[model samples]
Target: MPSIHKNIFTIAVVAFLFRLLMFFFVFEHSERTIRPDTPSYVRPAINMTEGHGFSGNEHPPFFPSAIRTPIYPVFIAFFYTVFERDVLIIAFVQIFIDTLTAVLIYIWGRRLFSESAARLGGLIYSLSVEQAVHAVFILTESLFTLFFLWAIIAVSCYREHCRLRWLVSGGILIGIAILIRPIALFFPLIGLLFIWMASPNMRWQFMRHGIIFLLIIAGIVVPWVIRNYLTLGLLKVSSISSYNLLFYNAASLSTDLHRISQAQARAAINDQVTKELTALGWKGDELHSAQLYTAWSRKILFSAPIRYVYIHLKNDINCFLPDVTDFLELIGATQGGKETLSVLNQHGLIAAVNHYFDDNIWLLWAVFPFIALLGVTYLGTILGISIQILQKHWDSLRLLFLPAAYLTLLPGAAATPRFRVPAMPYICLLAGIGIAKSIQCYKIRQQQRTPI
Candidate 1:
């Protein structure tokens, strides 16, 4: 086999086996695989396959849902129909998709940097604890990551070749990704910016291409918006954004102000919203309720705007923290979250450290490797980005850095390592470049020291 083909094959095998092992380990502890939101996805999927249409009402009448998007649930529904509603089957499919994503990361690295960098990037992504754990869970992260990766790769291709076809492909992939997870809603705008930056001299030409790219994304997404309008009477792609704003974003802010737990703040806000709605003679419909939630959330979030911004930016930092619980939870090393982010949110950073050692001191040996890998990756990313900045490597920044920053920042206070999955490919690629560059620098220094 050619060297490139051999490297790709090796990466694929390692990724497959690693994810497969993690899946089996989770299978042995099946309860750990199910999360609070698992039912939201799985139940709607099963409802679809059972002829109830796309609903997650969890009761008779099975009303159509406007909260979650269609593609991911439909993706799940197809698997449930074929595989008899087996979670393991769904996990296996995710593992296969994630493996492809890992290989694509290698391709992304090769395009941006060197052969060795791509190989290393692919390996780092494959062995990621976050990637492995989320692959086995009944969540959108794994599948969304695949589409997200392709979408970004398509953008890079368009940047290099300035081809209309690449824009169309990227639009389609990003549209699919948005359907799977609404967090990608603003990414198309970023794509346009990247295009504009890529060919600054050809402003008018790139602008035309940018508009066409956006139109393709709109064409893909508008049907879903129309469906939502006709069915729910709401002109929104998904109601999840409102739900997150109320429960997560607002709740986090409330927690900081009230000095109460997030759960308590959520309950309090729920009661307050319910009372206000009742007082206003609310009809208790999904559309009006979502509108109310968004309004109330914005009110609360903006009431203490400075504090909310502080909390949002502070938690953005949490995106990079290593959470070994992804593995430890499956292997039964710990129960619930004693993660640094969780404790830090509740009791501050000092307390978070104390709590980690206090509760799971014995697991330090297992956790160290994940933390070390995280540190190394971040160090490498810093180096890689530094080099790019020094060289004025705008393509690398546009392709990798912007998306990473956008994905990392957009999650706000809800940021977690799981939320970091979409950004991992770019980060790993940058780390690979940094490592490769550092080695080259070291070799040069060594040669200079040696006798001629």
Candidate 2:
């Protein structure tokens, strides 16, 4: 066991080193100096350091707050205060946080699974060029992923121990995470399910725990809600839904060639979109602009729900496929590459292929098979465990389903391999179980082969 753990530690170290090297070499050269959303965050961080509140004006406070989370910009702000402003320092700090996230993955895995499985998860995550590449940019995904995983680990610890403090701490952390990325609101629901699973026999006890947990989460989130209300003069539950509705509706329209050709027509259509959002209670010039840019998107969904669903289904399929974008672009397909991919591909085919391969090797091989196997393993594990708690069946499974459902549902709307990163840890846990079971079977077969 000691040797096994040592080996796992070695693997984790090597994986971290490799990721660091890649970040310095390949990613440094190929990645954009500024990410698509960098300005939205960096400007806010600067403003905050200069005594402004967490207001970016271009985006909600959550995104800017992300810059403050993980304490990166705080450190950067200190340096700027002492000497001068240097954005590169923040970028380097982000890389450090990104690496720290890999370490956290290993720690979380080791606690949840065996050292070997933890090592495997760390190895996969550390060497993940997709994650490495993303780390180079000043994007929220890396930091969001770190906090999100930390929340999961904290909640899982609470599940194992049934400690109210851990549960409350997990709620606070998740609330903070939601402030960084509003999508994390699903976590509280997931937590409720977990509480039910932990206290199956005591029905009132389960509800009591759940209600307390939710109240704790609300305590953390309410301040942000108040801030938004005061700032916008309207109660907004989440800043993302309006943005999502706009983006999804707009992106869905890109599937039509005729729509793609008429740029002027689309521009006019987008103006109507702003009018619609204004009618829907969306406010602010920035919000109005995003709505206008994506107005044509409404046509795709509102025009034909069934057809839009069918098109999204096809998109989900293509998201998993290995085909390159230039091939699609050559044929005049409008749906292939978005801004990130277009920027990556501007250099040439080699750069494009490298980017695709780095970001999606898991999609090319691991994710699909793991997803297929996940259904079986998750069901088998849940059923096997739930059988032990048959008296509390609903409580046992609800926590797992709510978060899992939210995680699964998001990918269908914007199907990309990168979008699936948050769920990979869970998938890794399932895959680890399946692999262990296969090894146990092999061990039994070998034992049977021994001569009497």
Candidate 3:
């Protein structure tokens, strides 16, 4: 078989089989452990599809809510309108999207590095167990990852080709992604900074693309912001993130005290939260209450500056850990989380060299190697990005948008598996490059040692 054909076939088979396992078997856990966010999304989707409104009126007397954004629920409604809202069907759709993500990663790697690196990166992404597991959830990660990857690709294209179209498209996509999850609310600003910092020689080119990109982004987001303002008197797209701060700081406070349950602490805050919000002129609305809770969290945090430092340090490290369980809860794991852990244990190719090796009990099993690989690739991407920035490697600096996104989320509350998945494709690209470079070095030394 031809090399291109061979590579394509491998990618196809690997993507199909791995994701098929997730969609068919592994995803049973998702249905079994239905997450709280699932019903929230489903209720809004049903309302939209049935001509009610974007109001999350799961119950009869449901009113308009500015809490959840409409993009993801609207997407679900689109599918429900055509056929039905089956979890299995959603799994299949996500599997397909995830496969295409692998192909995009391959193309991105080819453009950024060598063709060999591209293939390796694509393969690594296809076989990434964490991502496969993530697809099982009826959440925002799969769709968010898709658009995020595409936007990065488009932005990278504009950098290479100097086309305003790619920049505009990237901006529009960012707008779409924000509608699903507000994580990218600040991404346009980050992107603009990246553009200006990217190429000192191409100031005119950067200015043209940057302005167009920002304008289109503003066009996409301003309407939602306006709607939020008019309806809730708040100039925000969604108020859901206020809870992240609330919960994170609440958990941090619990840990500092060392005897209270985070859950109990959170529950206990309700009466005090109501009091605080009422004092602050809050009219007992969900969004306003969340604002108060967030403020209350901040109050707690600032009051104990030393403890705040310790909590933030811990949160940052935990947020980046491999095969983490905090994310498992977001996906609604239940006991399958332990099963997932047991399944992830395994030794590496270095261990394989010792063919007679037995007693795997001494080795780190299941998810350890996957976690180790993730750590290495992520750290490599960080190192590679630092080099790119210092050397003014303009074309590649845009890739920093993803890890930056993850980093912003890190200091907030908790780290989960899904949080890390978005950054994996680019990290894999760098890892593949590192692996290829190592192989090249080893081969060169072997040639030098040849006795001619």
Candidate 4:
């Protein structure tokens, strides 16, 4: 194998080892503590494994829940039947998933960018503390990242090969991704934009392939939509989206009005939203309430278009700075078996991360660089992609899905570092390319400056 491939393997190994070590040490605090709460994903897994038919019939059991899609829980249940809920073993699997994501980044970078950029992107993703941090959790992000990256890779393959089969495969992977995280439901639509742009002249060609992609995606997703319609009497895949919008709208309004600090105002808004849902056949149904509240959210968003723009921009910028306190709490939940969200009542995410590493030079050294890179990459990706569009280069345009994904997922409750993790591989790619371009320019300048 070439040195680059060998280095990629080494990064993957180190990522696995680093995650394992963190799970045993920093995450768990060296001893297991009794879990304070059970997550929603666990019940469906247990139910599915015990022949309950993919239902979330535990911890406020809902018969035929349309609140969430079943893929991640089914994922857990599959392993549970074999390993019997070994947390360490689960973490081991996450390590593998995370490593695979890094390898995919390398492939994506090489295919869409230069070999050097690909190596840099892969290395950054492999060693990413933020990405690895979530690996030990039982949440959907780790597995979601895996399928999401592969989908991107498969899409890249379709573009390069121009094969209808590859296009369908990409759509299928996206279907699976939405099953894991419903927020991804609209992600497939991006293909439409890419397809038209790639072959603006060959309208017939792009439309034919695009229809195949969408039809395959619909084939994968329509069944779940039908299940939801049959069970919940709603023509939707999941109701969580409405709740997500409500939280986003509520948070943005509270922030914009400076009402989050006022307990009565927050409660009043939440209560008012709840009542609005109740009026719309919610009947104390969380799922239906989510759908109803979403309507209210859109109404509010449209009512104040300028404010909505400001809110969107604010949340977009905030996506880069993830909440450390919430993340540490997430770590406590995963490793220490404690679940709490009280830290959210405190301060900004940047301050929280800084406070966590207070006076720890060793950790600060590692963490600061990561933060710096995230900021730089966020800026670099924006500038680089904008340049590409202006120059009319369409080769790497599909990667816009990263920013699109980020923006789509951004309008919820609040932004956190974890929320930003999924898009980082692409950010790293653009930043890697940016760095390579800068070095080349510097070399050219130096050569010109040489005295003859």
Candidate 5:
């Protein structure tokens, strides 16, 4: 085994080099194309700087023009203040964060498993095309993942030593991460449950710790609610409108449907669909320009809730499935998306080879089978560890399991590969233990077989 510092440094170098190569060579041309939410963030941050009250769409004051939390944009704006609003620089910063996340994954894995497993996990994560692609785009997923990983690290620290301050620190990180992305609100509560389940005899102690944890979380969140109230005159906690929109429009016609001008019946249906949302409480410039995106979403839900559920599930699955061809075109390896198939035909052999590899990267989903194998191994390790804890009656392991289970189960309903990435270190750690245990058993059997 290598020294811990050496292992970390090696992983960092490899991860950084991989990400830097992708940032410079691959996404160089693609970064200019504004991502889905880029304008929303840039415009609102510009508005905020201009001293305008938060007047973004269906979202609360917290998100403003951006559908995401404000922290990452604020960080981006700080860079813009210094370096000018070069999308390249912003993209580079995101790449750096993505690399940092890889480092964190390695460190967390090392603690949970062994150095080799940590290195492997970090390398796989660093080279992941999905992570690399997303990193180049200006979006919340990369930044949100950084904070999410930090929260997990904080939880691991708290598990190692029962310190109130560590618990509070973990709570605050979870709080900020949730603010960044509302779905994270489940973390601290999950942590608390893990703690309680781990500590049966220390019930009173756990309760006190939980109370302090909640207070720390509330301290961070309550002020944001206050700001939202002052700005919007609404008593909402965080941004509820986005969720409403997602819930409502989870099954609407594709935004591209408007392009088919010859289909008068389809166009009429689209117009009626547009009007249906405005007829609801959806108002304001954002809704008007965006055509009551959330309101329209809600209308879809109201019309057929069950159908919407099915559609969202299908979409989530599709998000995970390999779309190598589309992704290749997205990264400019193919001439498919912008040009007709006839035009692509004119490009000849070299271009065809590029297109073939680009379009087929979705085959990487094949890795999911290996990941699932690791997951099963991790489960067995967890069970074995749980048995040990039960025999020893170790409360800390029990506490750790609570948060671990929460993080695992919460995302199962909407499982995308990226969504699953944040949990990879934990999974890898468990898998590493399983591997280590098998080796130990093998060595023991060989020792028993030796005859004099």
Candidate 6:
């Protein structure tokens, strides 16, 4: 095998083994593996297999799902249909997908940076606690991430080769990714902008390519929009965006305005929105419900636009920070997820940290190293981006930094470490370059200091 192939294979093996161990560790904690959103995906999969189409009958209203797109539930249905409805099989599949993503990260780094950087990028992603943690959960992150990487890789290939086929492939991959997670619906625009910025002289030619790229993405996404309109009477891709805007973003602002807990804010908003919707004679009407939420959230969001922006930016920062609680919870070190969130809402972030560590002191010690590793990784990413900026590596800047920046912002006030999973590969790629550059700098300094 070539050295690059051998190195990537090793990284993939390590990633697979690590995630396999995590699956075994957390599979027993059905709550942790299934999660709150797991049923939303799984039930639809079960329904699909039972010939009920994409409708979810979990709550007896038998509503067609407008919040979740079809890709992930369909992914789950495949496993349930072919292998019996064992969630373990689904988790195992996610583990394999995540491992493949790590390999792709290596390939991406090699295409964008150096071989050493590629190897380091693969290793970094393989050892990522967040990536591995999400793999064990029956969430869209793993599969979505796989498609997300493929999309960007295709775009990068298009940039290098100026091929229309690569643009079409990128559009298809990104469209599938959007179905898996609607957060990426605008990513095609980002890709188009990158292609334009990457090729300054051939602007007109690339413009044509960009249009074709976007048309293909629209071709993929518009059908879903049509389906949503026909079934749910909502003229959008998914209602999840509107739901997040109201429940998470606006509720967060409500917490600050009302001086109450997040749960209380959600309750308050729910009551107020419910009464308003009822008065409008749109109760249980999915389309108007979404429109009402957008209006309510916009009212609150615009009332304190600056405050909301601050909150959104703060959430973006949190997206980069290490969140070991999920890992701890999985291994039974922490008591439960709610306790920590409750403490945070009741007291503050510091109090929550103290509460978590005061009880799990030994586990804190165990988790410290991984936290440090994450810190180092972020530092390296910063340094690497700085290097790219100073060197005027626009392609590297666009490919590595733009998506991370976009994903970081797109989650808005809903940002969490979980939301950060899709950007892990890009972060690792930049970190690899940064770490490699730092080592080279150190070696040069060492030679300069030695006697000639």
lDDT of each: 0.85, 0.54, 0.68, 0.66, 0.57, 0.86
- TM-score of model number 1: 0.95
Q: Work out the TM-score per prediction.
A: 0.95, 0.69, 0.83, 0.83, 0.70, 0.95
Ranked by lDDT from best down, the candidates are 6, 1, 3, 4, 5, 2
Positional deviation of residue 150's Cα in model 2 after best superposition, in angstroms: 1.8
| Model 4, span 180-258: residue lDDT tens | 8876777777766666666556768878888888888889889999988877787888887776565655546555666
lDDT for residue 176 in candidate 2, whole number 0-100: 71
Question: Each candidate: how many clashes?
Answer: 0, 3, 7, 2, 8, 0
- Count clashing residue pairs in model 4: 2
lDDT (tens digit, per residue) of candidate 3 on 1-452:
98766777788679768877766554555563245577777788898877777777676655666677778888788888887767666767878888888888887777787788788778888887777767666777778877887887888788778778888889989888888777777777777876676668998779877988988988988898888777677677887767766665655565456555455556666667766777878754766876676777777777777876665655554345555343334334322222221122123334432321234323335446666767666765565566566767555655744544554355444554556677677767766766666677789999999999
**RMSD (CA, Å), each prediction:** 1.9, 7.7, 6.3, 4.5, 7.7, 2.0
Name the candidate, 1 or 6, with the larger lDDT value: 6
Task: Give the 10-residue window scoring lowest on summed lDDT in candidate 5.
Answer: 253-262
Question: In lDDT terms, how accurate is model 1?
Answer: 0.85
What candidate 6 gets wrong by more than 4 Å, as runs, is 59-61, 278-283, 337-349, 450-452
**Which of 1 and 3 is ahead in lDDT?**
1
- The per-residue C-alpha lDDT of model 5 at residue 10 equals 76
* Model 3: lowest-lDDT 10 consecutive positions: 337-346
Clashing pairs in 1: none
* Model 3 CA deviation exceeding 4 Å by range: 1-5, 26-30, 250-254, 257-261, 274-284, 304-310, 324-369, 372-398, 401-411
Decide which is better by TM-score, 1 or 2: 1
Off by over 4 Å in 1: 278-284, 337-342, 356-358
Instruction: Report the error of model 6 at residue 417, Å.
Output: 0.5
lDDT of 1 by residue, 413-441 (tens): 78877778889998998888888889889
